[model samples]
Target chain A: MNYPNGKKGSLTQPSQSRPSGAGNHAFSNRGMTLEEDINETNRFYLDTDKAIIHKKPTPVQIVKVNYPKRSAAVITEAYFKQASTTDYNGVYRSKHIDFEAKETKNKTLFPLANIHNHQVAHMRSVVEHGGICFLLIRFTLYQETYFLPAEKLFQHWDDKLKGGRKSISYDQICQEGHQIPFQYQARIDYLAIIDKLYF
Target chain B: MNYPNGKKGSLTQPSQSRPSGAGNHAFSNRGMTLEEDINETNRFYLDTDKAIIHKKPTPVQIVKVNYPKRSAAVITEAYFKQASTTDYNGVYRSKHIDFEAKETKNKTLFPLANIHNHQVAHMRSVVEHGGICFLLIRFTLYQETYFLPAEKLFQHWDDKLKGGRKSISYDQICQEGHQIPFQYQARIDYLAIIDKLYF
Candidate 1:
């Protein structure tokens, strides 16, 4: 099965040891999740000595911990904290790369509320400091991902603040953002787009 | 008082918070930890817009969450996850900067165990890719900090693999690493050293 993002899903007969592929599991259509695909691509990049990028783990504030014998120290009480920056950032070719990856099922427009105010401020700082910053938006319904630079995002964000549309239309994204290629191992292949725009 | 690199002894008092005639909490002389000082310095840099550097939040693997009515979701179970990279990373002058900070009470030698194998590997990758990478080591007893470059650290790490010394002597570090100056608001002025050395 070929997904809209160009991800190929493999079909195989059910192995008796594995649970029957049905119900909730059906949502995963064999093609990896966008985050999973990006992770794999990053791993491939790391292994081949190309670029160093990592998904910043979700931030959580731990309150209570239990040290059980013969087991690891387990955190019992915690709370998710709003992240001050984006989900992923690292260095590629001596340049700082900062970005947020968000997937939306809606196909018409990517909502501005999907991003946080502090994140916008951080991306602005990165750009002002001469680092490369952008947003990786995946339209799940369409299975297409686009890389929107921080400058363009700032413009749209400011426009929304000025009582404009709170979301950017799909057509505008198609015209302004760089479409990331979908490959097998390199999945998102965002760096390929970077090679064109940045290099 | 000052503690070891493992970050024990956090139970000192606020009585020492005020140093004599300093008009503030300057007993940082005996009480403030190196990490706290670095954090303050990073805050100062951010406020001044000199450079953008941040400590990545501690990674926690969330197991369960509770979404109560009309409030934020609360994480109920989680575990601290081993970080895959260095503690601090960001861009300085359009150059990628990555580093790990550790303080030791041991005045003569800084043990190799203070650093993890993966962290060393990650720093090596950063250096190989032309990004600036180093270890910020503080000798708590002497109130001294040194920036040990990744290249020098890799040499010592490789020597350990060859059955050499597992620790680098303070004298050796004093010769190889750049001594970072302590400042008032910019507590650990490592970037000042970067301005001198890299620039």
Candidate 2:
């Protein structure tokens, strides 16, 4: 029972009547995006009152605008911009949980460049402050998602300074990170890993 | 020197060569919004590595777009969207900080309606999870600001259900909340109050 891309967490009973294509298998919910799955899962969390998490909307810089008569303002110019913070953050079991989700079709290694500098510093700041922070990396080809703690990430991030590997091998992720279970309703059920580690 | 609205936290040499309109006296910054003051102060914090805070961009739902040849796509239609979370949130001194900034020209009372139901719920959730949550309220006419704790706000919010007053008097806020002093550079030096209370 999946609604369209925009109708998320509608503060009421999940409405069933939407577009025709409602189901996606594995990672295919009508060309379902990983972000879509996570958003839906977060909605599920909100519905059951399990936890409150939100994906910060993509930041856009609106430059020019026109006020059409008797209509909403039309953005004549705008550009998608870089986000300073991680995509997802919220509270679970009265503890702060923050993480970034990334996916790569490449099967062997997860490129370190996929993460931004400010985002890394942000994650570090969170963890140092006693908040739970991690990286949710998904391999699209393999359909596998791993939760890599910020501490482990910092170690690899620092290695680049010493002329180390530019990316983390998939094998390293499997060994150091926990696999995130994929549920039909909760596409990226990251809380499972959070519960095990934090609790 | 203030950069244009879009060029925020550009991580380089503070770029002092922007527009010159630095000092603001008692919340008077030559057509500057409260948001601008906080943003500048946050940049001061970021450049000196004092703290990391950001005003979450206003969420907008872009409905239509026009892509011309060899250039960025231009958003043609969009509507300002409601925020599911607060406008400002960040990590300071290793603790989670969340708040919503609001201003009212009314001198007598701060209306509860200004604070949304979901936002109030969000703040409560943050506090229940042991994070610091509060509201930064500005009395525009008086050029006075106060940091109203989420707990105190919740008391008033719930009172509405119990047939209590719909707004908090300016005097009540002054007594219950911490007055945020207006400064030259750090306009709303809220972190000062936070340091005294939380740290």
Candidate 3:
């Protein structure tokens, strides 16, 4: 299928050496982190009146603060706390959208260790309460990002608890998950998958 | 109307002396801050499978970190960042829920300075996107908490920008907002108001 940005060739040939052209601009984004791309895409969605989503700030446990006479208070000692919920959440078309994003350089499989048990429980509760939840898994090696519904993730998660495979193979993900098209503005374009699966 | 948890008398008689009875236990919670009360209420909501809401972590800008050998990375230089969105957001009854909570010791008015311009803008966008948005205002002196819809807040917020009153009068809030009933488990029972207004 034709990708949204019409740069299908570049997506498939992620590592190919090509002459500097219009597509080179999109290739510059390759160095950007998944979080950066999603943040940019969320901004585009907000500016276009398509969605209201945001990444929650990193959880930090502040221990000490120093107040200078003529400056803002500075945190002197703090530690990072594990997030209990997913990274991104918001409203789209009157529905609550909740999801966590992860990029794996592994070409063979996506490790289950990347996700925490509490987050899986939280996602289950969100689904039970009638909210839309999913995971954005990006295979960095192939430049492929897949939108995996939370329900599909739960199956793999539950299997691991019962001594099944600790990771999901690349072939399994491609079969079970929807591939998110690359777009110039909306780099991740996961919402496009949402529109098809939900709306 | 009779309030939930059968503590209506305690809610109205904030300063009245009462015999140390079963109700006194509930009154002990008076010393808790609005944030503490809301956190407890949210925990109750989660435990009962009533809703899925969480307070976003405080936004912090980390500038320096020290990686001590065999120890967690310690943040050495960080500063608080202004939050662009509301504090609490999640889903309830198949609808997106978003809100900010504040407590005012002022008996007459809730100062508009307590809320930032960008936060007001964020609330407006949430409403436009079909989310259930509101404000949880607590009058500490009166021991009363009110759920103010974003629509009513916008009226006063816009008026303030146009050189009107810089604060919302307590009386006006009582007229335009729904008083959340004080409960034992759900300290600030805001969801009860949501059920009436949105469900």
What TM-score would candidate 3 get against the native? 0.89
Expressed as tens digits, the lDDT of each residue in A40-145 for candidate 3 is: 8999999999999999999999999999999999999999999999999999998999999998867789999999999999999999998999999887656677
The share of true interface contacts that also appear in candidate 2 amounts to 0.44
Candidate that would win on TM-score = 3
Residue pair clashes in candidate 3: none
lDDT of 2 by residue, A54-117 (tens): 8888788999888889987777678888898898887677567788998776669999999999
Q: lDDT per residue, candidate 3, B48-166, as tens digits?
A: 99999999999999999999999999999999999999999999999999999998878799999999999999999999989999999987766778999999999999999899999
Cα lDDT of candidate 3 equals 0.85
Rank ordering of all candidates by DockQ, starting from the highest: 3, 1, 2
Of the two candidates 2 and 3, the one with more favorable DockQ, higher being better, is: 3
lDDT of 1 by residue, B98-168 (tens): 99999887759999999999999899889877788889988765667798888899999999989999999
Q: Which stretches of candidate 2 lie over 4 Å from their true place?
A: A1-31, B1-31
Q: Could you give the candidate ranking by TM-score, starting with the highest?
A: 3, 1, 2
lDDT scores for all predictions?
A: 0.79, 0.75, 0.85
In model 1, which runs have C-alpha deviations exceeding 4 angstroms?
A1-25, B1-30
